[model samples]
Target: MGRLALEVADIFRAHGPAWRQSQQGQLSLDQLKVMSAIEQCRSAALGGHVLCCEACAHTEIAYNSCRNRHCPKCQASAAQRWLEARQDDLVPVEYYHVVFTLPAPISAIAYYNKAVIYGLLFDVAAETLRTIAADPQHLGAQIGMTLVLHTWGSALTHHPHVHGIVPGGGLSPDGERWVACKPGFFLPVRVLSRLFRRRFLEEFDKLHCAGQLQFFGDYAALANTTAFADWLAPLRECDWVVYAKRPFAGPAAVLAYLSRYTHRVAISNRRLVAMDARGVTFRWKDYRAKGRTRYKTMTLSADEFMRRFLLHVLPSGFHRIRHYGLLANAGRRANLAKVRAVLHVAPAIDSTARDLEATVGALPPTFVCPKCGAAMIIIETFTGCRAIRAPPKPRGAP
Candidate 1:
């Protein structure tokens, strides 16, 4: 198990009581379902069949998983499968990881209007990237990218951000040649930031004017146009932060990066430290560190913990992962074929080994029994508190 895995475990152990106690606090019916689903995931509430390793006589019945996106234990395979499918979309060019973050001022409003705001965040960020990169003076190419929305910071705070993995080049309108970005840079971060801010604010104002925004608590007074304008006035003076990282080393690195967040929940099990009575203790990375090794342990009251975790439960039917530009859903296949032709790259091998080789550094559904040095397989699955029959014992186990 890795450090994150441990931290998640700690959070589970510590916050169970608080979560149960504050069931009335602001949880939605869906959030309740997710919590229940995660609790029973892979447990024997939902029936499952069994498979034991042939070599090791170590025998254990595997439980089925809910396979819900919010279930941490189950997202690995989902992310990996998604990554595998996207391999065909690779354009044989440099890839950039760009992050678009929201300011604290907006995050507060976003907390109440999550689905709407998060959706706007995705659209505005994608539009900004596409618009800027397609400018002739910049790159003038129609780039392709995969975008994912993340709603939580390392400390489980409500920080909304978009993480995009984009190919460095794009297809020319004539489809005659690929246009590559500057070797080390893609778009100017500052310019992208300003444009993103303007677009988002414009959409926000439109929503407010149409009475689409709901204001309650301290924000109730801000529902008035004058107050709303006053609230947004300071944001224009502030610099919105949009930045791109150095290009990924290659396609493999890109896949690895995507897996971390593809089906991720607000938190993972590995981050948990200890859970007996004293709220939840977990490790969080302090990203401000120059050495990149700085980490700290935080303990939150169980009620507060659940509140933070639930803040990220997305609205139903929302698409969290999306493709745009050359990798757009419409013509990804033809575009990918052209890209391969241009690079003289062979088509993907139709073998699991090939996918595994491409993503060795990132793995999915790699579960091992902590009690026994054996792999754990799924035998039964449960949706909520219901129980599923346990799998029968292996052929012969004492």
Candidate 2:
């Protein structure tokens, strides 16, 4: 802990109470819980583990992580574990990156109706992709996509967008053959944009009809259907933003990209430049600019910083990362095998054999004891407690 100069926890520990008091009635229970968890994470308040290197007898006390999904410090291990599990799921094919962004008009209403709107966002985006891909004039295949939702832009504003990683080819309609896309292209962006806009607005209208949407402050008038329709009409005339990037270099690069985005939090402590009376200064990318001007720092008041950070806490039980089509969790395993068979690729290799083959020539012994160069053992562990101080000493330590 001493090695790090700053942390999100430090901000919460210092200013959280005052922030909470200021917004007592407005803060959601989930946000309150997240603040408490981050403030207490890896500190004496959460207890810790007592580890001793068997070879060198080096003793260390390690505190517990809060494990809250929003905590930046906790995502590294989660990403690694998730990537390890997904490694075997990788097929030998080019993957495409597609993004679907919510329009500015909807983004405002979405702030107050996150659960309903975000769910529609995911469902509509999936439906749009699947429908377009299945068109005979296009790919004429049932492609798979793994979609992740990100609600913040580079400046940490509430910009809702979905990132989709799709396989370049897919199974045939009869499930009897593999259908490959053009060597470099996935689908027509203009077609995708039009369909996504129409579909999402259609779904948004349904939610509005059901009275699932709420409007407040400047948007209070949108609670009426006529006012809402007038607002949504502009979106129909303007183009929605849905575009795909070039195919990934290989199967490995897909996993590498997913790792960066899958378990990401709003912001990491590393980006924080300072948190003084002038407020918090941090780095951000200005997409509208070019070259050095594109990368810039932004400072927001401490109160404003915490408010924007909490803007992305997410609704309880909401699933931000989702799969659709062949990648749907229910059918992914069987579907992968079917695709491989049709493509005449070798059967899915078991994890053990793949690991051995991939690492047979790699370096070794990075975890040896620092003092004696011998391996160490994790002989014991202890769970956290609210008031606990230190972990239990190794069996017979003084």
Candidate 3:
């Protein structure tokens, strides 16, 4: 895919100032930081590096990236490094993609109480999975789950959902063997749905009672306990969304799956079709529709588009990617060791110093000059926010 001349950065740079002015008193500090980071990312404002090829004298200037998690431009390299670290954690087994979605009513509340609500989303969903799995009627084992929080739907709407990557099996009760679920099936979605709904709604009630949730706009009345309870009454009566998709074919497929969701932003730059006086045009999938009609383009006014994009900006230091159950940080390593032992799986191949060098050595373009195919070496170093005069004209005449 060809890079777009205009990016989300460009949109932010072109229109962000006015948007900020319009919402001067309303935008959160975290949201403002997101706007500024995206606006200045890879631009001259962030400073840059000048790279010169020793072999061909080819030169280029590369700007510094903001490296913000929300930036669409910076996620690729971050995903790659994360994948490398996680490569060793993959057990040779089937994995399932499960989703736990917040109902519309709760989603509305989540907009104002993001940190509290979203944190509970991760906690409650994870507990639901583990609770069901550990019961004797179900799998009766402690499972591992990697949960990712996604707050946007296909249309860039404020649809809050958690996507779970779960291993198809778990360590047995006695810790003696691996207990695998049915080859193609995971937990029952209906059962999962019921439990997830009960746990989250119950926890939400607790949050409200403890004065943790906030309200604004039409939901301002929810700050009162009775109104909040009345509002949540409909939610208790309605079915919550929980789905367990078919198992991934293998480990490689699991990696491919993680790549799509792990570092995803609300929208990628590639989906952007155009930006003009009328509005911004972009592609979206209508999951509710069928056949060719499902995939189509949409246009929104510049202000509205930015509004939707900013809606998904997470609270500062809030983790969207989390590990729980056996994958939880506190005891994950020991748990995985037992798992691999139970399965009799060999130790994962760890890359050595030489192996790392060889891996990098195998890549030609990263080290080679693109123009003349000559190997490039860094001849000098310059710090950011400073001008560098090009390498003394290669010390030769024109």
Candidate 4:
């Protein structure tokens, strides 16, 4: 039996009351779909079947998962597949993890205008990276990167940020040899931060002019262009957050990093501690502190937990995972070819080789009895002892 995390179960438990009182009026069709899908995720609600263990002749059963991208329980395979596909793109060079975040002032706007504003956020960040790196003063080469949109902070708060994993260097405009950025310095954060802010707000102004923005509650004042511009006035002077972590030790480190961030939902199952009438308790990291002081647990009422979780539900069909520059989807193959030729790197291996490595790589040997050398196998899978069991098969059925 698969144990449901209290954190995840709390989300299901709270949905009842939240749906009855959501301020957004009736739950939209898409929201309802996500809610239903998340609840049915690893449960028999979706129906499942039995799979007897081949080695020990042990009978057991496993419920099929919803396989929804948003389900925390179902993201492992997806992450693995993504990493396999990206392995070929890995060059024998350092890779940097950078983050671009919106100030609290704009997160409100982003909440309402998800598709449009979030898209704009991605565009501005990508353009800023490209423009800055292409300058003669900077690396002066085109870089490749994968960008992921994460809408929640560590505590499940409605904080919007973009996480980018960038190659340490790129090809020069002349397309001859590879060019490397200074070690420990990808780009000037202060300058990149300023440029990002200016570009984002400029595009935001256009969005406002086109009447594509919606204002509600405290943001109603933003309906006026002057008020909106004034609302952004503080950001003009503030230093926007653009963070750069030191480059990973090697290309393999890049894959390890992607495995953690790529398929992460607002929270994961391992963090849950308990759930009861009081609320749900789960672990969270306080990135600001030191040592275990960084690891803390918090409890929230079921309703509050659900509310916070649902706050991160992305708009339907939004592409949260994306590639930019030489890694972009439209012409990545051609571009990568050019990049490889210029760098004198060999062509990428076929998909078959990539798939084999993903499924078999880094796996430990299966459990086996120490004395007899017989493989240990599953005996039974059940939600609880009292749950109904499958009836014995009819004689001669097979």
Each model's Cα RMSD: 8.0, 6.8, 7.8, 7.8
Ranking by TM-score: 3, 2, 4, 1
Assess candidate 4 and give its TM-score to the true structure. 0.86
- lDDT against the true structure, each candidate: 0.79, 0.88, 0.88, 0.82
Question: Could you give candidate 3's per-residue lDDT for residues 1-398 as a string of tens digits?
Answer: 34576688878888899989999888989889999889878877787667677777998766678999999999998998888778778999899999999988889989988999999999999999999898878888889999999999988999999999999989888888899988898788889999998988899999989988888888889888888888889888788889988899899999988988899999999888889998888999999899999999999988999999999999999999999988998998788888988899886666453477778777765446667777666554454564567866655679
Quote model 3's TM-score.
0.93
Q: What is the lDDT of candidate 1?
A: 0.79
For 1-398, candidate 2 gives per-residue lDDT tens digits of: 23357787888889999989989799999999899989988887777666667678876666788889999898988998888888877788889999999988789889899999999999988999999999999989998999999999987899999999999988899999988999889999999999999988888888889988889999999889998999888888998999999999999899989999999988988888888889888989899999999999999988888889999999889999999999999998899999888888888777766677557557454245656766555555676655648988998899
Off by over 4 Å in 1: 1-21, 50-58, 342-398
As for TM-score, the candidate ahead, 2 or 4, is 2
TM-score of each model, paired residue for residue: 0.84, 0.91, 0.93, 0.86
Winner on lDDT (3 vs 4): 3
Local lDDT at 333 for model 2: 87
Q: Which is the winner by lDDT between candidate 2 and candidate 4?
A: 2
Which clashing pairs does model 3 show? none
Instruction: Evaluate model 1: give its TM-score.
Output: 0.84
